[model samples]
Target: MVLISLGPLAGDVHLLNRACKGAGTHEDLLTEILIGRSNEEMFLLKEQYRRTHNKDLVQVVRGELSMKTERMFVMALTGTRDESTFVNHQQVQQDVETLYRAGPGKIGTDEIAICGILLQRSDAHLAAIAQAFPQRHRVSLTHMIESEFSGHMKDALLHVSRGAEQDGQGVYRDTQLLEAAMAGMGTKDERLCYRISRYHWNRPRFGAIKNQYQQLYRRSLRQRVEGETSGKYEKALVGIIEQN
Candidate 1:
């Protein structure tokens, strides 16, 4: 079912397993895994190695790799841990710092690649990422994007960052979401209406991100989309946000 046999992971797995059997140092397996393909599958391999060999996979990974290779493996494996918001936050902080150093102009597919790894994490972790970016970069990640990124990539980053907020549940609730939306709008009745709508949307348990917009917002997230957007343009933007 999985294409593992054909990817960078193939030989890497055998090497890792051999190393886990005490035939090689932890560093050896770490090197192989760092260069391996398939993050999700690699996570499983690390778990398997630990189970079979009684080694801390991440510890080995840290000892063997450095720089971008190290960062990449760490992000991939740490994200796989899933429940540790602490790890997610730490990785995000590091990545945001890395991105800031690279500056807006240097951002590339790797930025999106690492972001893809991060999105697998819970919304709480992702939201913290959004918060961390501005703090670290001394600029809103959104503003940075507005300056350098455009079209789908920009849209994707915004969606990912937006989802970082409270697993994105807050974005749907009319009361909670609208309040967030209208926080600085300086309008009372509109804010009140959004507030009234949110309580009914429920604060948790959106089946998917879009459901939050559809049920909680009382309009598809697209239909309600504002800001330099309207009509089908809003729909397309909302659609992107919903998907990410």
Candidate 2:
């Protein structure tokens, strides 16, 4: 499974356990569970994870992942993301400069520094930073992240970046994730199911994201699913897409 929204702490715990229990972690699933969570949400998740799994979520993460990816999850597990809608332009500029130095301006990528800024900023503040970064560096922050990072770390950072909204629309990231599940030759059934299920919890917003998905790809998300999946799976995925 790829993701879930807040609440139903048990679902989050189940997904986290599934991601971390085996030999190799499920990076995409791990990214979705940990990214975009509020401090309170993360607190509930950590508590639930311990009750359900009898292991500290952070400790399990430390044991499962290594290097920059591990550091990124650890910072996210701190449950300290600034959640205010307030944007600080000065700080955004500073972060932009820091990212520039950490990425394109440096000889080698400073992965942790980049992780710190992405992990700490509020969504509103991060959206501001994303805008300022492109203006200062002549490349979009998403593009820069793609250039400088790879693997799970890159995916997590991209999740953080796109989670920030532009012009008050918050569906872009979700829309992108939905398409990613069905993109390429074969469909990612579990990811597709989890993503649609996650969004289906909020009908109105899910409706908006689905409409945006159609606008972006010039084909209906439902139509895309119809083409990629068949049998009960096709009907089920299409039903959810159509429900939106």
Candidate 3:
């Protein structure tokens, strides 16, 4: 259960305030609070932010962030991309075709179409889309993505399209997140916090994520964090991961 200290909603609002208050935008803090929340939770947080701060959350984020990240947070705050639990089969097929033509069938990947459809739809819808994709196109959505896109865009599309199931691919998703966090010269602290904060409270899901991390990487999530970071930050990350 979510701990009720300041109240989850109030705590989220304060986190956002801190994210926007500093000399530079604390993208990590913003990402941790915003990206991990459900659409309904986010809607309530925005409402509470306005109630407490007398300012719109989206507007506040807009002033502090820019470009793609700004657009993503705005969409997330407005609850535009939250998916409904119920699936529409016809719409799923249409989305599959749209995604196909936007990527594999075209000369160049249609980043707009890809992001708009994949990011906006609910996980259930995406699962349905993934299920139907190969039936019509003779190719998996994952394969199509691998063929058409590269780098972070590819990773995001794959992660979103993987649906809510905790299968092998879901495990792979956790590994990818760990790799992203620890990749390159310096740690991507925002990405690390976002992934941990998003699932740390749910013991079962977080356990599965940790299991996947160990199976795929041959190292525990805590070990990875310990190796990549030092002192308080590393302790904080390991604490979050180990939290039930």
Candidate of highest lDDT: 2
Off by over 4 Å in 2: 1-7, 165-170, 242-244
Worst 10 residues of 1 by lDDT: 191-200
Tell me, by TM-score, which candidate is best: 2
lDDT of 1 by residue, 166-185 (tens): 44333432224443543454
lDDT of 2 at 55: 87
Clashing pairs in 3: none
The ten-residue window of minimal lDDT in model 2 covers 1-10
TM for candidate 3 is 0.67
Q: For residues 1-244, what per-residue lDDT tens digits would candidate 2 score against the true structure? A: 2243344577778878888876888988899888878899899999988887788999999999998788889999999988888787888899999999999999999999999888887878888887888789899888999999998899898888777645333588889888888888788888888778767767898888878988899988888888888998788777766762
* Candidates' C-alpha lDDT: 0.48, 0.83, 0.72
Better of 2 and 3 by TM-score: 2
TM-score of each candidate? 0.36, 0.89, 0.67
Stronger candidate by TM-score (1 vs 2): 2
